[model samples]
Target: MRGADCASDHELVRAKIKISLKANYKSNKKHRKFNTNKLRDSSITNKYQQTLERHVGNLEQVGKSSIEGIWEIYKNAYMKAGKEILGCKEKADRPWITLDTKTKIKERRAIKTELIKTRNPIKRKEI
Candidate 1:
């Protein structure tokens, strides 16, 4: 077998094997990301605080509740308040490569293919 483009005394080895890979599936659940930028506004902040306080006050009457139960009340209150006041942020799917980047990548690939076609080392270097 032929080695790679790098300068090395090592020869490439070929192997034949059967390998099975499991297909990975993405989850259907949407991520809960609150619009924290809304919190910067004084009015929004005040509303969130008021809503959270009201929810917490209402849930605080669980008699002889465990520490975990109390923590759950606090968590649920905050989540509900944030969801009502701030709301979840929308997911923006932007392209991974820009137009300029794609053009540059095409230019590089063309140059590489030209270099590969050249038999002379000097011509490859010039390319």
Candidate 2:
């Protein structure tokens, strides 16, 4: 009787081990499918990114000449003002002027020129 009982307990343990192994295999298969789906989605997104980048490049090329013309106009204006106010002899290239500094200089010079012109008339009238 004791030996039969032992044999039944051994069979129960084997059955439980088999159940656990099947559960583990099912989980691994689900994980593999999820990873494959993520890889497919990432590849699709990369293709879209490449397509958008190509479109942007095409648009930039179409506008290139007009952008250059505008830059030249701004450059000439800056050089003219610099020569008038600061006694700068060299022509200013657009890339050479730091915009914020140039703007501050322009504002300061405008104020100074206006004040000088206004004060000069007052001094002449007094004389």
Candidate 3:
């Protein structure tokens, strides 16, 4: 190949590289769980039903063209009613294991490792 004269003596190397990258689409949306247990109360149930009905009453008047649009309206109404009436359930922060149990577990692990490393049977038994 003839090198271009206008530049330095080193020949220009041309190459094509195709790189394929995996798309990372992470959704940070957390689904809210409504407190359905509140519906067991008669007054709360009546309030929820009335709120839901009021939200959906005007749906026919809006006259949405597409099925998706109608569905979106219905979904929004239901979500709004539930959010107002039921609210989100609070998450409990209780620990699964007590701190005392955790410390004992660590001690057990340390003793097990010591037993594994000891060469003499007597030391292993002592461990």
Give TM-scores for every candidate, taking all chains together and pairing residue i with residue i: 0.65, 0.19, 0.64
Candidate 2 Cα misplacement greater than 4 A, ranges: 1-94, 120-127
Task: Please provide, for model 3 over 1-127, each residue's C-alpha lDDT reduced to its tens digit, 9 standing for 90 to 100.
Answer: 3334332435567879999999999999988999999999999999999998898877556585587877877898889999999999999899999999888877766666576579999887777
Q: How much does candidate 3 score in TM-score?
A: 0.64
TM-score, model 1 to reference: 0.65
Model 1 per-residue lDDT tens digits across residues 5-124: 333446688999999999999999876999999999999899999998988885448556898988898888988998899999989999997999888877776776686579999888
Give the Cα error of residue 26 in candidate 2, in Å. 78
Ranking by TM-score: 1, 3, 2
User: How well is each residue in 1-127 modelled by candidate 2, as lDDT tens digits?
Assistant: 1212221223232233433344443444321111223324666456545544443444444466587765665555544433333342334467766899788877766654465467577764643
* Rank order (by lDDT, best first): 1, 3, 2
Q: Least lDDT summed over 10 consecutive residues: which range in candidate 2?
A: 30-39
